[model samples]
Target: MQRLVLLMLFLFCFGSLHAQQTEPKKYLVYLSDKNNTPYTIQQPAQFLSEKAIARRQRQQISVTTRDLPVNPAYVQTIKGTGVEVWYTSRWFNAVVVRGTAEQLAQVNALSFVKNSRSLNRISSPSATNGTLAVKNSSGTSSEALNTMLAPGDYGLAYHQANMLGATELHDAGFHGEGMTIAVLDAGFPGVNTIPAFAHLYQNNQVIGTFDFVTRTENVYGANAHGTSVLSTMAAYLPGKMIGTAYKANYLLLRTEDAPTEHNIEEVNWLIAAEYADSAGADVINSSLGYTVFDAPSVSYSYEQMDGNTTIVARAADFAAATGILVVTSAGNDGNKTWKYISSPADADSVLTVGAVDSLGVVASFSSRGPTADGRIKPDVVALGANAYVLNSAGNLVKSNGTSFSGPIMAGFATTLWQANLSKTNYEIIQLIHRLGSKASAPDNTLGYGIPNYSRIVTGLPTLGAEEGVALVNPVTGNDLIILLADNWRIQLTELQIIDATGKLILKKMLQPDQERQTIDLQALALQKGVYLCRFISGNQIATIRFVKL
Candidate 1:
């Protein structure tokens, strides 16, 4: 009986030891305070770059506790407890760590530790079977490389820029110069060596890079999604292809782990955003979105996409509120069961972009949404389907996803902001929304539609005289009245009304004194979409937008 009892005790001890060895889990340890931190709000220069501080000063934003770094002593104490610190978020006052249950318990016992929660169970890469792996290529096609390197006109790319009136913006000398953009994505494997990015390298436009996934500066060794995404904004192989913001500087940050998806990536994104804010990024383009995760237990539901629930969504809002223009993709899940946008894309203040085709039609695969809170999401649309992008193999490829669309819009937005340096980020966002194709009539499929940069630029306060044209009941059933401001009447030479696709639907040569005329579109059988009315009076031109219901 004594021998049997001894054998049972040995088996129980062995079982406990085995469980302890194999069951280590990842956790997010929330800290109660930033007390005794060396940084302070008054010493903003220490935490924020000169440009970042300049932006804050221009916008009248104040430095607060959120800007302070996490206490090093707390991190050190957690590390001393044998818990490996994965990442720390100053925004949330928390640190992510990996350790056994016993170690986590010890961390929880510390006075500074507020609370801790299990993020998810860590599994081997093989165990995941690419469940949540980022869909991007790591290898380049040789044929594509040769074809892409050959000089050609801005072939397929012109359509994208033209659709949003970005070509005109570029012509006006607003090509995102003197702007800084931060791209957070899964990775950027060949960005350093790509021929298309040579200008960015030569001009020192690639200002910074970091891998939050691995906690290293080696961000150019992972997946190619970021490389393709960055190409939409920074690639500058003139004649062949040019990005929307090729002249803008960039900071590349890898927040998504292509091999896995978990809540931790959201935390990583928040941390990276804070880093970008400190680094003085004028625009942040994040092609990464989160909805589902490898661990089913921790996956977010559609209800959580209310623009405030998810950690990443909150972070995106914070980034926007802090004077940075945040742009995120509206996820590629239109055909899936969860046919709606994911977090960060659902963020209210951030510009959530949806995917459209070269013909300016919403892509079937583009995510749609009135966010869980019933706010019209995807603030604008951009050409993402068959979007031209430079791959890791130095080849221009046609990529399809809102991932490309967000960066394209972001680059253009930076250019717009560059032109209007006096405008605050919020004002810029509002202007972009107000200038969209369907601003008067927004829906979940493509909220606000594509932006009209040409119209926006023409309407800027710095621009000469404001166009006195206004549409009374812009969304009219059949009759549309073009009201002219009661200013000195100028002889109307030619009036042209064009559709969203720039197709001239009606052209009329007006009499010299014909002012405030009403056009009856019932005769022409107009469809329900946005249209532009161009008025030519001598050398002066004024364009007004109206909607046909």
Candidate 2:
């Protein structure tokens, strides 16, 4: 997992002209408060070179900051010292300072300063321009399909299980048990009471929620997109349809203020994402897209769709660099003349998601992209046509958009991460691309076809001190026992027995340290036959074939 960080926008790009004078040196100075308590002081002026100020002014950069002390009087001394002040947060009790080689040495020589570094921002492409809008759900419900449908029934599910690399993660036991996802979107409607969400509530998975739109904690607004997205990851069912991640936690953030279009909503999203980060979210699933604004003059041009031009795009990229998986919808504009992805989706690091119809064809409404920088996008796809969701009136409904597809992919990403705790965001992404391209080839429509969880299951490196498969002998009539191993080294945290054809027969939670555990096979409504026993420990995982005598 990447370390999660979210950077808010200031819209100032500082430019400095290097002087030909003796090349300046940079240094990191640790300023000790001398006392353990938090402290604040004006930034020394001797640190900012004269050239830096001209650039700051040109960039409209302001010195006043709540996160850092910015007294002009104190800045003068640091002038020409080739030093620069980057980020300062009182909570961290530290201010990042930068200066040319010599200037850095001078700043470090001063007292009361803490630490300094050669400040470098991670480079990312510009964000897309477009808005992520969720349509109203039609009051309807699909008959409980978990019992009747196989994972292959939904193109998205099949992609994850057999195509992408999702089945492997599920087998590794990273069904997102302890991870937290902050879903920033429209309203959740009746998520709290929906049968699809019952497991989340019963398992205490719904840790916290808020509505930035209404300034309230409850987010059951009339929109059903949020409900559908949530269900893709958190819905729990045994022997029926289980989400890609059956046990992940969620934080619903209602940031969309429908009926009103204002720049403030973007700010609201920023604040909401900050709140999510503070809450220790492992992933941020935002199906919302942004592009044209209510004000035509403010609307973004194709060139401006460069990820760096948009405030939200910058923040989204920063969020990914920080380690949180920031997933967003590519937008439903394929049929339009623009036919391009929306903002933030243009963001380079973001996992821009598109939608695929039932037959694996790209949904006509799913956004198209060859980002401004020429990066292929809509990194993945999932079912979005006539998707299932919950309405405000506590009923299931159907809706369609790249919106539904984003969450479905997010659910798979979370589960994948849960399975391979050691895998970096880049590696996870590469694996996704690897699986898809290996099966077929990459294209703008689907960067990596869909993820396959099974490859990861059989391919992840081995773990623990023990090795080899364990044989379990039946003790009595209709007896069943699971011979477990710390295959992932984290432990054999969970086990699920299913028929070879993919019908789930039983589910069990096993202690990581325990090697042998007995499960009541007959109690699980299973018939005498061969079964696949899935084991999840950590990133390492494996499945064994067994016969239920």
Q: What value does the lDDT take at residue 117 in candidate 1? A: 79
Q: Please identify model 1 stretches exceeding 4 Å from their true place.
A: 1-24, 123-153, 457-549
Q: Model 2 residue 450 lDDT?
A: 61
RMSD of each: 10.7, 15.7
Best by lDDT: 1
Quality of model 1 by C-alpha lDDT: 0.78
TM-scores for candidates 1 onward, in order: 0.76, 0.59
Kindly provide the TM-score of model 2 when superposed on the true structure, using C-alpha atoms. Answer: 0.59
Q: Taking the tens digit of each residue's C-alpha lDDT, what string does model 2 give over 397-465? A: 567888877887788888766544445555556655554533356678876766555443233333222
lDDT by residue (442-539, candidate 1, tens digit) is: 88888888997756523333321365556665566777776665441565556667665444578787545545667778888988876766665543
